[model samples]
Target: MIELKSPGEIERMAVTGQFVGGLLGELSGVAAVGVNLMDLEHHARRRIKERGAESCYWDYAPSFGNGPFRHVLCLSVNDAVLHGLPHDYVLRDGDLLSIDMAVGIDGWVADSAVSVVVGTADPADLKLIEATEVALEAGIEAGRPGNRLGDISAAIGAVARRYGYKVNGEFGGHGLGRTMHEAPHIYNDGRPGRGMKLEPGLTIAIEPWFCATTDKIKFDNDGWTIRSADGSRTAHSEHTIAITETGPRVLTRRPEPGEGAASQIKQAAANS
Candidate 1:
C-alpha cells in the first residue's frame, strides 16, 4: 500500500536527504583518476557512522540482488549502471562512475544517485550523463501535486528520447520512506495521463537511467552490478522528492559548490 508522509515526517526525511545529497556531491569531488572504488565506499561508511545514520543498502537482500549487500554505497563504473558492488578497482581517466546511496536518519530514509566522469571526460559520456540529469529534473518537475504519476514517468521518457538514449524499463524509481524501496513502482516510460494521481505528502524517488546504445542490460557475475548489454556506456540520476500543495520539493537536492550548510558538510567530508 502507498503511504503518504506527514509534514513532520517529510522534514525528517529531508534531514536524511541532505546527508545523502551532500555525500554524493562530496564523493563526486573525491572520485578522481587512480582513486579506488573501495576508498569511496570506506568514506561513505565513515560518514554514516559519524552521523549516526543507517545505511539502507547494508545487509539489504532484494530478490533481484545478490544476497545481503554489505556496502554502504553502490559504486558502478563505466558500462555498469545500477546496484554496482564496489570492489578493488582503481578509477581510470575518462571512466564514468555512478554512485548510489540511501540512508535512514531518525527513522526516515532518503535515496539518491549521481553519475560522473572520473577525470578526462569523453564527450559522448558527458552527453549521456547530462541526459540522465536532465531527465531526473524533468521527472521531479512533473511530480507536483495533482499531476498523475505517469506525468513524471512520461516527462523522464521524453527527455531520454530527446537525447537519443534508450531507457531500461526494469529498474526505475519507487516510493521511499523509512525504508529503501516502497510501493508505487515508477516506470521510466508511461502514458502521461495514466497511473495513480499525485497527491500532497506523496514522496517518491525519481530516477532516470539510460544507456548510450541499446536498452538491454546484462548482470555481472556478482549478480548485483547491472551493465549495458551492448557494452555501451550508461548513466543514472535520481532524487527523492515530496509532492507538496505548492510543488514538488526535492529532498535530496545536491548542494552546489559554495552553498551554505551543505557545502560546509562537503568540506568537512573532504577534510576527513
Candidate 2:
C-alpha cells in the first residue's frame, strides 16, 4: 500500500532520511582504493547501531532478491548496478563503486544510493557518474505535485537515452515509507501522465541506473550483484522524496551547493 504521511509523520521520516544522508556522506569519504567492500558493510552496521537505528537491508528479502541481504549496505562496483552483495572484493584504481543504503528509525524507513570512482578516476567513468547524477536531478525536478509518476520516469529516461544507455526495468525505484519498498513501482521508462498521480505526503524513491552498453542484465552467481550483461560500466544515483501540497520534497538531501537546512528542499511548500 502507498502510505501518505501526516505533517508530523513527514517530520519523522525526514529525521530518518537525514541519518541516511549523513551515512552516505561518510561512506563516500572513506571509500578509497584498496578498501574492501565488506569493510564498508562492517562500518555501516556499527555506525547504524551507534545511532540507535536498525538497518532495513540487513533483513531485507524482496521477491527478486535473495533471502536477507546479509549486509547493511549494497556495494555495487563497476558493471554491477544493483543488489551487489558485499564480499572479499578489493577496490582498484579506475573502478566505479555504487553504494546503496537504507535504514529504519522507529519503524520508518529511508533509502538512498550514491556512485563514485574508487581511485584514479577515468574520464569515461566520470562522465557516466555525472550522467547518473544529472538523471537523478531531472527525476527530482519531475517529482512536483499535480504531475504523474511518468514525468519522473521520463525525465530519468531522457538522460540515460541521451548518453546512449538503456535502462534495466528488472529493478527500479519504488514507494518508500514504513517499509523499504512499497506500492507503485516506478519504472525507468514510461509515458507521461500515465500511472499514479502525485499527491501530498506520497513518499517514493527515484533511482536512475545506467549501463554503458545494452540494457540486458545478469545476476552474479552469488545470487545478487546485478551486472551489465555485456560487462560494460554502470552507475546509479537515487533519492527518496515526498509530494506536498505545494510541490515535492526530497527527503534524502545532502549538504551541498549552499542548500540550507529546511530550505535545501526545492519545489516544496507548507503541507495542507
TM-score to true structure, per model: 0.94, 0.91
Give one digit per residue, the lDDT tens place, for model 2 in 1-272. Answer: 77788888888899999999887876776677777777777777777998899998877776676577788988998999898988888789888999999898998889999998987998888888898899998888888888999998898889888987788787889998898889989998777888788889899999989888788999887777899999999999989888888787888986532333223121121220
Query: What are the per-residue Cα lDDT tens digits for candidate 1 across 167-205?
Result: 889989999897889989999988898999999999999
Return the TM-score for candidate 1, rounded to 2 decimals: 0.94
> Each model's RMSD to truth, in Å?
2.9, 7.8
lDDT score, candidate 1, position 169: 92
Best by lDDT: 1
- CA lDDT of each prediction against the hidden true structure: 0.90, 0.84
What stretches of model 2 exceed 4 Å from their correct place? 256-272
Per-residue lDDT, model 2, residue 168, is 76
lDDT of 1: 0.90
The best candidate in terms of TM-score: 1
Q: Residue 32 in candidate 2 has what lDDT?
A: 71
